[model samples]
Target chain A: MAEAVAGCVRHGLPAIGLWRQNVAEQGLDETVRLVKDAGLRVSSLCRGGFLTAPDFEADNRRAIDEAAALEAACLVMVVGGLPGVVPGEPLGEISRDLPAARERVAEALALLAPYAAERGVRLALEPLHPVYCADRAVLSTLGQALDLAAPYAPETVGVVIDTFHVWWDPQVFEQIGRAGREGRIASYQVCDFLSPLPDVLLGRGMMGDGVIDFGPLTGAVAAAGYAGDVEVEIFNADVWAADPDEVVATMKNRFERLVVTRV
Target chain B: MAEAVAGCVRHGLPAIGLWRQNVAEQGLDETVRLVKDAGLRVSSLCRGGFLTAPDFEADNRRAIDEAAALEAACLVMVVGGLPGVVPGEPLGEISRDLPAARERVAEALALLAPYAAERGVRLALEPLHPVYCADRAVLSTLGQALDLAAPYAPETVGVVIDTFHVWWDPQVFEQIGRAGREGRIASYQVCDFLSPLPDVLLGRGMMGDGVIDFGPLTGAVAAAGYAGDVEVEIFNADVWAADPDEVVATMKNRFERLVVTRV
Candidate 1:
């Protein structure tokens, strides 16, 4: 977490999205102090979900406490998949009961939203791509995410639009407009999609290397009234293995050459 | 080419899609005879584009000939990307001129449609996912494919809706309905997306294993007036490496358990 923050700070990045595991590893208080001392904005915490668990109360409260300690702008929730885990295997498979899981997630969000708002931290529902529908998030589209956030005030709960996940969406522009009208646009993450990928989880392209037309995408978001800083969140192993400074330099260069040119 | 066809035949699979290189390897005359002997249908000839070439005439003409000889029901066009080859590398890179490439593909399709119709072969405009918008089919949506095919008679040119590509599309049902209403639903291929996949190309799942609600999708296509056979096309390396008989058995089981139940 500190390495990622230091890289961003060196690269002159304005904000950083910290993952919960990282915060936990460093101790939340110390992590917050480090970020604060570095004068970096916590764009949002990486996540706080899995509310579909049978034991929701304990998990949800702990998540709230962590988000509060981080002083996160938003807690980006990657609502968990199925109920249980098999021995020796990771718990990343979806249960057959999607509608029920969605309902549980919504109920948990409803419970947490007020608490989050009172603490001055927005709870952002990050709708993952449909590919992640089985194991990560049931909310797969921008419309669905916005719909989930519909009952809550924008300041309480909103949606995050990650271009890697949502760029393939035909209704992206219209949904961005809808999100804007509803004031649900929370954060926008940009990345490209190159084919014949090596790792589904980590092979995301740098900003301008793939096929997403970012200019029109950002334009649509801006037209929808979003004026937030564009976040470059790539999960590429290739990028991660490089010197962190080089990675940030490449990200910054791609941001200017590819993304900025398009915008 | 022979291996694919033999597998299809041995498996009692009704149809198989073949790439041009595969066809070339077996020689067209023997390949046609082999397919006929197996009583298998040629669902689609793998591809017929790369139309962005300065001289589209040669590639286009050869593709038409192959499709005609193979007696393919549809010539699935993976319209090419950029022009020019960087020596020693496959001519597979993002095209600098996307608009021009799109136009070239449209022009080539327009020119080939008549010949395809004359040969009783349908030209299936495959709208690839936007991930391939740089170096593959410029047609990135069913709506866009339909728009491209609008000028031609449905009998001459139609659209191929591959579930692997279009399953995530929010407007899928809308565009599918439109295709059905216009009598342009040419071919429908079924596959599933497995998240955290090992390889994007070969990791497509068997029907029920992934996130796709194929029941609703198949029903929508039937409602759209499509009466064609649902081709169970999986590109999994594990499945391919397994005994072909087992692959067939698994596919058949999935069809009966999932697809048949839905339809």
Candidate 2:
């Protein structure tokens, strides 16, 4: 975590999105101190949703507290896949009730919204690609995320516009517009969608390395007036095998050439 | 093809969906004769869309003629994916224009609808699961398929409601309702969604063998007033490797217990 903070400073990047596990491992206070010492901003905390768990409220409250301490932009919420997906096992339809699972998310949000608002931490609902609808997130489109965020105050709950997830959606641009109008464009993450998905969960490629046309999407975000930090997330195995510095360097280059110019 | 027809007769099944390739290999006339001899109805022809291909028109017309010759209910259209995905090569974003690919489908449908209509054949637009949005069919939802079908006569352009594909959709029941209202439910195909999707293309499991709650969906189709042949399509490797007769028997057993009762 220290190295990661230093690496961002070293690479001349402004912010970083920290995963909860890493923050737990690094100790929250030390992570905050390191970021503060490096004069770096925390773009957002990695995740804190999995609302399906029995202990969701306590863990999520802890995540909110951690995000508050870090002064993170928002808490990225990957609101769980289905009711009972055991890790390291084949995904089963323990319950094939998707609507009920989604309702659970809405109810969780209602409870968490005010708590997050009190901490001044925005809960960013990350709508994963529909491909992950069965195993990662029931929120599969920007439109669905916005609908879930509708009843809550925009400051209390927002949405993450990840290119890899929403690029395939037909209503993406319109939803981005709605997100902006509603003041809920919490974060804009960039990555390319690869094919013959190497790994369903971690098949994202660096921008320009896959099939996404960044110009229209980036321009749309810009048009929607999302003047926020653009985080890059590539979860490919080959990219993971490369040196961290090189990966960061390539991300910056691709963002500049394929992403930034659009805006 | 002969065995499939014979098996259907032996199993006391009334109808079967025919793939164009299998029909050609067995000689189209012979296929028609075999089905006729066995008193088996050709519920629908396998496919004819791939609208992105340069030869889509000629081929689709041929498929239309084939469907007509067999007196099939419809020509199933697995509208092609992105424009330039080579068969054995990695799926590249040779073009990241999904909207454009979809537009191509609309255009192809405009031209072919009249042709299909004259032949007394319905072009059944099958909205493949969104996972195949990039590599199989640009039409990713029943709503989208319905929208595309809206511009034509219901008989000329209808939609296939495949449980394996549309089961994950939040708007599925509503769309099925709309399909009924629009008189566009041309076919109802069934299969189960398994995970760790064995192979993206062939991961479909036998009904009741996976997570699909067939009762609600089958009930919805039945409620939509679709009194058509319920086609069983299990593409799993294990099921495919099993004895064909045994496979048919199991499919019938599962369908009776898990699917038929729902309706």
Candidate 3:
């Protein structure tokens, strides 16, 4: 973890996103001190939105605290799918009440929004691809996330516009425009959507490794007035197998060529 | 093909869906004659909607004619995804012009609709799940199918309401009602949606085996006045490996308990 902070600092990367597990693994305070001392901005905390989980309330409360402690821009929330969810396990619904499940998210948001506001942390609701609708996240589109955010102040509840999740949606550009109009675009996460890929949990490819024309999407994000950190959030097995140094180098290369170069 | 028709007759199953390939295998006229002789009804012909295919025109015309010849109620269509699709192959794109690919479907329907109408066939458009969006059907919602069908007569371009394909949709019930009100529900296909299942070609489960709450969805379709054939279109490997008689028997049991008995 310290090496990651050192690497980011050495490489002149101004920001790095933090996964809570990684933070916990390194001792949250220690990890925070390292990144803070190394002059790195925590773009966002990994996640805090399994609203359907049994321990959702306590878990999310801590997530907010951790994100606030790190002074992260936001805590990305994957408002989880069916209650009884385990990756690779057969999708068994504890309740086939999808609307109620969604209601739980809004309901949870209402409870957590004030708490997040108190802690000076924003809840970044990410709309996962619809393929993950059954098991990962029920929120499946930027527009829907914006709708969920409408009840709260934009700062309290904003949407994360991940390129991989929204690229397939025809309404994406229009929704991004709406997000801009509504002041709801919080984090602009970058990834690629290679096809023939199922909604396997760890199936994301690097920016240029897929068929996504990141040009228009990134353009839309920039046009949306999003001047924030663009996190390279690839989750492929091959990428994971590669040396961390190599992955970092490749990520920087792709971000430059595919995202920043366009900018 | 003959055995399937014979089995349907012996079991007194009212109608059987036919794949175009099976029709071709049996000699189209011979299969048509066999079904006609057995005093059977052809509920629907399997498909005719690879609108992105170069030869989609002549192929769909032949499909329309075959459905007409079989006296089928509708010619089910899986509007082909990404131009030049070959299922199970790496998701290749002839062009990443998804909108243009969809436009092609509208254009092809414009050409095929009149011919289908002339042959007394309804074009049943099936919206496969969004997971199949890249390489299968871009039409991922019943509403979208209906939208496409709107520019043509409802009788000429009708939308299919398949339970498995649409169960995850937040707007499914509303869309089904809309499909019914528009009088565009040409087919009401039923199956299960057990997730953790990737978007593999034959990954579908039987009616009762999945997480799908058939009660509400089936009730919604029934409420929407869908008095059409309820086809069980499972593509699971385990089910396929079972004895043919056992499969049929289990299907009947599930169909009665989960779908038919609901009525």
Per-prediction TM-score, chain B alone: 0.88, 0.97, 0.95
Compared with the true structure, what per-residue lDDT tens digits does model 2 show for residues B199-218?
Answer: 66777899866667788888
TM-score of chain A of each: 0.91, 0.96, 0.95
How close is every model to the real structure, measured as TM-score?
0.82, 0.97, 0.94
TM-score of chain A, model number 1: 0.91
lDDT of 3 by residue, B182-230 (tens): 9999888887776777545666788877667787887888898888887
Instruction: Order candidates by TM-score, high to low.
Output: 2, 3, 1
Q: Report per-candidate DockQ.
A: 0.21, 0.54, 0.53
- Lowest summed lDDT across 10 adjacent residues in model 1 chain B is found at B82-91
lDDT of each: 0.75, 0.87, 0.84
RMSD of 1: 4.2
Q: Show the colliding residue pairs in model 2.
A: none
List model 2 lDDT by residue over A66-154, tens digit each. Answer: 99999999999999767776433685547678888899999998999999999999999999987677667888888889999999988
lDDT of 1 at A25: 93
Candidate 1 similarity to native, TM-score:
0.82
User: Which regions in candidate 2 have their CA more than 4 angstroms from the true location?
Assistant: A91-93, A261-263, B91-93, B261-263
